[model samples]
Target: MNGVAVGVFVFFFLLVTIMGFAAARWRRAKALDNLDEWGLGGRGFGTFIAWFLIGGDLYTAYTFIAVPATLYAGSAVGFFAVPYTIVVYPIIFLFLPRLWSVSHRHGYVTPADFVEGRYDSRPLALAVALTGLLATMPYIALQLVGIEVVLQVMGLQAGEDASWFVQHLPLFVAFAVLAAYTYSSGLRAPALIAFVKDILIYVVIIVAVLYLPSKLGGWDSIFTTANDSFNAFNKENADAIAAGDAAPKAMIPPAAAHWAYASLALGSALALFMYPHSVTGVLSTRSRQVIRRNAALLPAYSFLLGLLALLGFVAIAAGIKVENAQQSVPQLFEQEFPPWFAGVAFAAIAIGALVPAAIMSIAAANLWTRNIYRAFINRDATPQQEARQSKLMSLLVKFGALAFVLGLPKQFAINLQLLGGVWILQTLPAIVVGLYTRWFHRWALFAGWAVGMTYGTWTAYGVPLPGDPDSHFGGPLELFPGAETTKVYIGFTAFLLNLLVTVVLSVVLRALKVPEGVDRTRPDDYTADLGDEGVEAEIDPHEPAHA
Candidate 1:
């Protein structure tokens, strides 16, 4: 909490912003028009840039703060995020190249655009687009949460006696800068800034992990301290469950908890690419081989993530305390790191927020421009118009994320993010399954999305929180009694519901002689590579007359 450290962080934060805006000229694309150029970094990122950009976009500011916070909050389950990152790259290795192939082949910018072209169903594409937009908003908000925790730790926010608006001004300024640069520079800003962001993050985490152990005695002492605290906390939880004092059931046994960890890890690994921002990163690459090479290399970041999650244990051992579980990582750094290093750590956290927030805004805006604005609102829109509209929508999207950050309880960001996963998962049948085959009816996919959204929302609302005033309307559902099998991921659960409805409805719809949408894609299309598709020509239908 050194003011000098805070000043240093502020300096680096501004430095990144200057670099972000300057990226528009760095690669120096001939022109920055259309989704291809503005929204996808000219779709020409080389191996090195792609590695940092995708890593910065995916690992995110939230990862800087929240993952360790969970570890600090008394659950081994939080460590699930690390293994999930490891598992995710291999899974992406299987499908993402295909996705990239199809996207490049068809000049598709968003996954919903792929669905629209594949099935010739505007409604289905719209459904996918809306789901992406919904899922991404809270995610963008969580970036603000990352920055907020850093500011809180720095003692930059107004004291407890200050007005709410006064206390949160830094949060609002952070949002404003993110929105402005993203709108002006699109994906280019974050792509350039990712270099600085990743370097700072690695430095901060490596320094903190190495330096913090001595202050907390040793690794053995740290783990023993953390284990003792967690054990005591669990004992109280056990007593509450035995007394029927807590809602749902007890936390899973350590063994069963491992399954929950593996499942969550695997599920998240599968779902990560389905997110529009991650897809934007995937699609921005110059070739499928570039993506493949990066996939192998990207796991290197997971090693960093593993260490990042361990910081939670570090926090607990250091005896750092915060009212919010999300503050654990920041609090740990504030306690152990020097003022200057703390500033660098805070910059890592702040710049981390900017990278993903920029990409998420771009992804969401691309969806709006391609799927909604062009598909339904203006079919004849030009690439220039598409870029203009996306820029405007990017602003609105960031503002909406800011509103979510300011308007709701802190826990709402977490819940909404989980809810977002549920929403995005509904698109699996339309986006992922449609990649290989179109056996599933397009109409059936729409029905499935509808049912999944309903079930996921209802399930989320029915569960209650621990030690909260409102008992019945807080958290996700517990699936089995006497077991700690709560459904934190309503998306996976709802996807099953969606799949069931889709299968049953497909049968019913086909039996009723429903007119299925035209299928314009072939299996070969999914395997198409760069230089084969003429994506630039397809995206810009009207080439210049002089040319």
Candidate 2:
């Protein structure tokens, strides 16, 4: 192990840890027992804090590691992350402010809280809550992958000769500290620690982008190296593709991958804001203005994301080689930078994993506490009991993620995350569309959700990984149904199918005089600001919020 690198990493990590625990009193709210206080950092964050928090929550360790890894492995298709982030802000701007307004006006905590309040359907709320919890656990598992890769490059975790327990013990120790602080601090831990994570990431990625290229004869040499390597890699894969022995993996996806590229971009954009952790960030902000301003400003992270993606090609020019593509960035830093700076870069990535993991665990815990435990288990838990349960459940969720990474193959975690995106996007028809018109019957929307979830899972299960026909759930790309020649993102196809079913079912159900649920909101509710006074559960049967 590299002692100096480990030393520096430990220093920054411990510093962040201290900051995390202190954040319990950072804003000094009136009480820590309520959902507003514990689940959402008192829901009083201003522009700057929310900016870093949302950036930390959304960009994730995956963006830093996997985006580059994808580029390193497949080429142009990996850059899809950049454009997806660009489009997401504008799209969320259209709906997120309204979600925040409605949720804030009604004192709703989780997205499911809003779903149940808007539709007056406990089952639909439970469906949203369960989906969020399921989607978040695998995402938390993937962060450990980021941490393990960093440790491997730091010489802390390596060699098949090492015992499995010994290899993963460091990771367990790190996450344990994360769990402790998050339990004590709630959302505040991640909100406070995000400052450090984002700063280090920006510094390391910016320096890597500017300084590394000149060492390898600049951008021209970098792209030339990447292109030449891809040519060689593609030539070998061509025969395999002709025999249906491999799926498309290349610099550009060739003629056949256009639909997949566009669909992936669009599907990812739609799904990004739907993640519970992303909504937690949006809801924590002080006002709708905060959400609007950030929509224009947060694209800065997307700019950084694009620069980070280019590091894959740079790794090629630097002659970096690693068995796992995830290790490409960490190993590159270990080789090129001095031991001390390499440690800093490694710490940046590990901390990157920590911030999002903390937020994700909290988000999942909040969902369970509010929508699952309270709604189903007790139905009468006080705010204090809710906070207590959330704190304990946060620990359970993190350890569950630990079990996920250790008990199964890493590919299982990766595939689950892919499915998570698809699954979470299925809720869009119910939650997002409900934010506007309440014309759709709650039961009809619920049925549509069921249909979309079914079709999406079955199709995703059929996407085979080239030579491994027996092992499916390989990637998000699949042939559009009824047109095998066209491959597109499974999530978008599923989302479309979900919307179409909702429309058809709504028309039939409306004609049959199905009873629409009570809406606990008003016209002004959708535009409510931070300090608005409101009454919830106000449903009018004559006008079921048709507007």
Best candidate per TM-score, number? 2
Off by over 4 Å in 1: 236-238, 243-253, 256-259, 469-477, 481-488, 533-547
Show where candidate 2 strays beyond 4 Å: 535-547
What are the per-residue Cα lDDT tens digits for candidate 2 across 207-232? 99989988989999998899888878
User: Lowest summed lDDT over 10 consecutive residues: which window, candidate 2?
Assistant: 538-547
Q: Which pairs clash in model 2?
A: none
What lDDT is obtained when candidate 2 is compared to the true structure?
0.87
lDDT score for residue 432 of model 2: 89
Error of 2 at 269 (Å): 0.6
